[model samples]
Target chain A: MAASMLKVAVGSRAYSSGIRDVLWKLGRLNHVAIAVPEMEKARSFYRDVLGAQVSEPVALAEHGVLTVFVELGNTKLELLEPLGPESPIRGFLQKHRDGGMHHICIEVDHLPDAIQQLRQRQIRTLSPEARIGAHGKPVIFLHPKDCGGVLVELEEA
Target chain B: MAASMLKVAVGSRAYSSGIRDVLWKLGRLNHVAIAVPEMEKARSFYRDVLGAQVSEPVALAEHGVLTVFVELGNTKLELLEPLGPESPIRGFLQKHRDGGMHHICIEVDHLPDAIQQLRQRQIRTLSPEARIGAHGKPVIFLHPKDCGGVLVELEEA
Candidate 1:
C-alpha cells in the first residue's frame, strides 16, 4: 500500500509529521439517498413510471428507517422513510413535507485512512466509528455542517 | 450503440412495441451538486479542510449560478452559488439558510434515447429539450416530482 504524508497548515502552525496517510482513496459514488414521507409511493413511481427496477422495502430498525433501492445501470437511488416518529428522517420530512434529497454514499478504499485524513484536517465525523450500513458494508457519516450542509456517507468499496 | 426494449404496462394498456429504448445507459454518477450561500467559504472548506482538489469557480450566467468542482477519485462534488438575487439558488439558500444539496448529475451514453424513454413513460422533464450543462455537454433535467423529490440531471457521457 502506497502512503503519502500530508503536511497540513492550520493558521500559523504547520502540523507535518506522522501524516503518513494514504492519498484520498474515496471512490465512486454508490448511491444518492432521498427522504420521503412514503416509500411505496416513491417505489411505484420509479418502477411503474420511470421503468426502473426497485427493491422491496427493507427495514433497518437499527438505523430507524425503511430503505428501498432503485436500481440504475451505474448507481442506485435509495429511498428512506422514517420507521418511527423519532427517526431522523421524520424531522427532515416534517420540514420538506413533500420530502427531498438526503445524504449521498460514496465508496472508499480504506475507511480508516479516510477518517484519519478527515480528522487531521479538523473535519468532524458523525459516528464515533464506522458501522454497518444498509449495504452490509462498513460505513461512516460526516457531519453535514462541515460539508456545506451535505450529509456524506463513506462506505467500504 | 446497444439498445434494449422495455415493455412497460400502464393502466389498461400494455405498450410493448417500439420499446427499443436504450437500456439504462447512464454510467457512474459524475457529481452531486450542493448549493452554498458563499462560494469562497465552501471552496476553502473542500480544498483546505477536506484535502480535495477544488476547481476555480466558474460562472454560468444562463444557469444563474457560479459553480466549483471538488475532484475526487471516482466522482466529484459540485458547489453552486447563486450569481444574482433572481437566481434560483437564491431561493433555495433563503429557505435552507445554510444551503443544501441541490441535485445529482449522471452520465448517459445516448441522451436523445434517454429523453424519449422518459417521455414514453409520461415522466416530466424540466428543460423541454436538452441543453448545454456545466461540462459543456448535452444535458437535461428530470422533474423532482417525477424522481421522488430528487432533481436528477442526465448528461451525455
Candidate 2:
C-alpha cells in the first residue's frame, strides 16, 4: 500500500528488456489461505454457518501445518493450523490469537517461466525453488514485504 | 487444516428449521481488496512486474478510499488507499504500515436472502444494510471476527 513511499531500486538491465515480450500469463485464483489457531473452529464456521463442503485435514510435515480445503463453487479456502512447535502458524497466532488471512494463491500457466521472470525482476521469493503444494502442484511463495505486505503464492495451473 | 480437531457444536432449535431449502448460491469471486498507502506505486508493481492491466484510480469519497482494479483473467484485485485521516484504511495502516490484504469479495446470486440467512444465524455484518459498491452493485461487509478474522464482502452478482 505504501509503495510510493517505498524506495524504488533503479531499473535493472533485465527490467529494461522488452516488457511486452516477457508478460506472464496469470490464471484463476485457486484459493485463499487463512491461518487459524484452532482448525476445527474455523472449519465449523465455514461448514455449519456457510454450508461449505470441507475436505479431510491433511498434515504436510514438510510445511509444518495441517491443511484442509473448504470447497466453494468458484474457489477454495485453505485453513491452516500449526502442526509443530516451530510451525510458522504458531508465530502468526502468537500475534493474532483469533487467526487471520495468511496468503492468496493465484494460478499461473508456466511455473518455470514465471519464476524466471520474477528472478529477473529481482522480486523476493520465500523458497529458492517451487515446492509441491497442498494441491500437489508446483507452488512458490513471494515475500510479503515484496508483495505489499500480502504473502502471495503462485501455483502452476 | 485441522477440521478434525474441532469440537462440533450441538445443533440448536434455530438450526432445525428447513434452512437447507434456502441455501444461498455463491458465485465466482468478484475481487480481493487490498489496502495500499500509495496507489501509483502499487499500480506500477502490478502493471510492470506482474504484467497486470490496472484501471485508473477512482475515488470513492463515500467509502473514504481511492480504489483501482487490477484485471486478471479469472479474478480482479482491488487496491485501496485511504482518502483522509478518518478513513478506515488509515486505521489499518496504523497497525500494518506497509498495507495489506483488506478483504475478499465473493459474489452471491441473492444478497437479500443471503443477508437474511446470516441474520438468522446471528452473523455480524459491518452495516445493518447493504450499500452500493464500486461495481454499482449492492454489497454488504461481514465482520472479520464473525468470519474467522477474515473481512468478507458479499456482492450481489
Candidate 3:
C-alpha cells in the first residue's frame, strides 16, 4: 500500500514545474480551498445560496477528509471537512475558531519542476511527493511552517 | 473625492464581468491574499525564505493599506498590512485573534451575472456593487456571515 501510494505521489509531483510554466503563461488566478467544519452548511452558502455550480463531494480516504467543489467560471471554491478524528481539518477548525480560508492552490503546468525548485530552496512540503487530487489533477502541499503558517498548494492543471 | 471614488467604483463594477470571463478562460486558482500585522516579517517568509519571486510592496491610499505580491508559478501570494489606525486589517486581526489566512479569492467569468445569481438566491454580500481591487481587478466580497463565517472574494482575473 505504501509503495503504491509512493508511486502515486511521485507521479503527481513530477508535473510541478510544468504547472508553474502554465501559470506563467495563463496569467490568471485559479481556485481557493477553504476549510469548513460542516460540509452541508458550507454548500448551503456556496452552492444553494451563492448559486455557484456544485460538484459532488469526493471522499479523500488517504487524507481522511471529504471535499466539495464549487465551480465559478475558471476557478473553483473547495470546501473541506474532516472525515475522521485525526484529520488536520479538525485542528484547523480549532485554531481558526470557525470556518475560514484554508489554503491557496495555484494551477501549474509542471508539478515535478515546481517540486524540485521548492526542494532546492529547502521548503517543507506536506507530501513526500505529489498525488492525484480531486478531478484527477496532480497536486502537492507546502507545509505551513515553511510558508509562514499559510498552507500553499501547487496543482497541475 | 468621495463622489469621484464612488464613480470609479461604479465604472469598475460595470466591467467586472468582462474581466472575470477572461480569467475563466485562462484557468483555476488565481491568487490568495493573507493579512499580517507585520509586512516585513511576512515578506521574509514568502520572498527570501520560500524563493517566490517578489514584487515591490505598494500602499493603496484609498484602502489605507500596504500590499506585497509574491509570484509563485501563475498565482500570487499577497501579504497585506494595515497602513493606519483606521485600516480594516487591524479590525480583522482583533476579531480573529491571530495572523492567518484572510480571504480566498475565486476567479469568475461574469461578476454581474454571478452577483445577480447570488442575490436571487438571497446570499449576503459585503457590497452591492463590485469594487476596484489591487492590480485594478474588479472584485466583490461575499459576507462571511452568509458563508459560515468564511469571507469569500469573487474576482475577475
Candidate 4:
C-alpha cells in the first residue's frame, strides 16, 4: 500500500528472464495463516491488544481446524488451532511448540488454468484437484519443497 | 476486502472483553517475509513462474540481509537472504535448509505509544528501541515467544 511512498529501488518490476507467463493472473494475498497452539493468547494479542477487528472462532470440521479471522485492514490473518486428533497442523504445532506462521493463501482469477500451468513447470501441488477450503472457495496447496520451502495456497477468489 | 461477501460470520468485530485498546491502531499488514537460502531460485519462482512483480535484491548491510519484494496487489512478500556469515537469519536458514517463512511486518500509526503499551502488558519486544527498518521507517521486532511464535515487526508508517 505504501510502496509508492518509498523511493524506487532500481526498477521494482521483475522482467522475467524466461518467456512471459500469462497463464492466469494472481490477485491479492488473501490471508497469512498462523497455526496457534495457544489460540486464546494469540487471539487476545491481535484483537484486544492490537485493536483489530477479529472474528470469533469457527470450527472447520472438514479442515480439522478451529479458525479465527483477524482483519489487518488491507488483508487478514487466519489463526488456526488443531480441532481434531488428525488435524493437518497438529504435527506443525508439535514441532513448533509455541506455534508458527503456516501456509499463506493468495487469490487467483483462474485456479484451474494456474494449476495446469504450475504442473507444466513441474511445480508439485499437494493435491491433483482443488478442494473447498475453509473460506468456501476452491483452493489447492503447493508442495513446500517445490516452492522454495514455503507452503502456498492458491484460492479461486 | 471480501469479508462482507462471506456470511455474517457471527459479527466479526472484536468487542474487547475489557477496556478498548485505543493507545494506537494497527494499519494494514506491511509485508510477509520469507528467508531464502537459494536466492536465485526463490526469486525466479515468484517472478518467472508465479508471474508476480518482484523487486531486485537490495542488500542492507546493517540489517545483515539481502531483501527482495514480491508485490501481491494488496500486500507484499519480502524475500530475505543472509548478507554475511553473522546475518540474523543465518541460524534460521541453517535449521531450515530450503528456507521458510521468516517474519511478518505490520504497520502501526504510532510506534512509541504502541511499544509503551505493549511493555505494560508484559509482551516482550526483541529490542527496547525502534530502529529504522528496510523501508526507512522506525520499526521494532517483537519477541516471537510472546507473539505466539511469530516474529512480528511493528513498523511506524
lDDT of 4 by residue, A1-157 (tens): 0112122343435433233446688889999999999778888878766667677788999999999888887899999999989899999999999999999999999999999988988899998899999888999999999888899999998
Q: DockQ each candidate and list the results.
A: 0.27, 0.27, 0.16, 0.46
Label model 1 with its docking quality class: acceptable
- Give the local distance difference test score of model 1: 0.76
| lDDT measured at residue A142 in model 3 versus the true structure, 0 to 100 | 88
- In lDDT terms, how accurate is model 4? 0.85
Stretches of candidate 4 off by over 4 Å are: A1-21, B1-21
Candidate 3 lDDT for residue B94 = 76
Q: List iRMS for all predictions.
A: 8.4, 8.3, 11.4, 4.8
lDDT (10s digit) by residue, model 3, range B102-145: 87676767777777766655677887799998768888888886
Model 2 regions lying over 4 Å from their true place? A1-18, B1-23
Q: Score candidate 3 by lDDT.
A: 0.64
- Tell me the deviation in Å of residue B116 in model 1: 4.3
Candidate 1 chain A lDDT trough over 10 residues, lowest sum: A11-20
- Model 3 stretches with alpha carbons more than 4 Å out: A1-30, A107-120, A127-132, A135-138, B1-30, B40-53, B71-75, B93-99, B106-122, B127-132, B135-140, B154-157
What number of backbone clashes does candidate 2 have, counting pairs of residues 3 or more apart or in separate chains? 7
- Please, what are the lDDT tens digits per residue for candidate 4 over residues B1-157? 0112122333435433224546777899999999999788898888777877777778999999998888887989999999988899999998999889999999999999999988877789998799999998999999999889999999998
Sorted on lDDT, best first, the list reads: 4, 2, 1, 3
* Candidate 1 structure quality by residue, lDDT tens digits, B1-157: 1224455443333332122334555566778899998898887776555556567678999889998877665677789999976787888888777778998887878888888877876678997999999888999999887777788888999
In candidate 2, what are the lDDT values of residues B1-157, reduced to their tens digit? 1223233322220111112444576677788899997887787777767766667678899889998787665677899999966787898988988888899898888999889988877788999899999888999999988888889899999
If you assessed candidate 3 against the hidden native complex, which CAPRI class would it receive? incorrect
In model 1, the clashing pairs are none
Considering only chain B, report the TM-score of each candidate against the true chain B. Answer: 0.84, 0.85, 0.77, 0.88
Task: Give me the runs in candidate 1 sitting further than 4 Å from their true place.
Answer: A1-24, B1-27
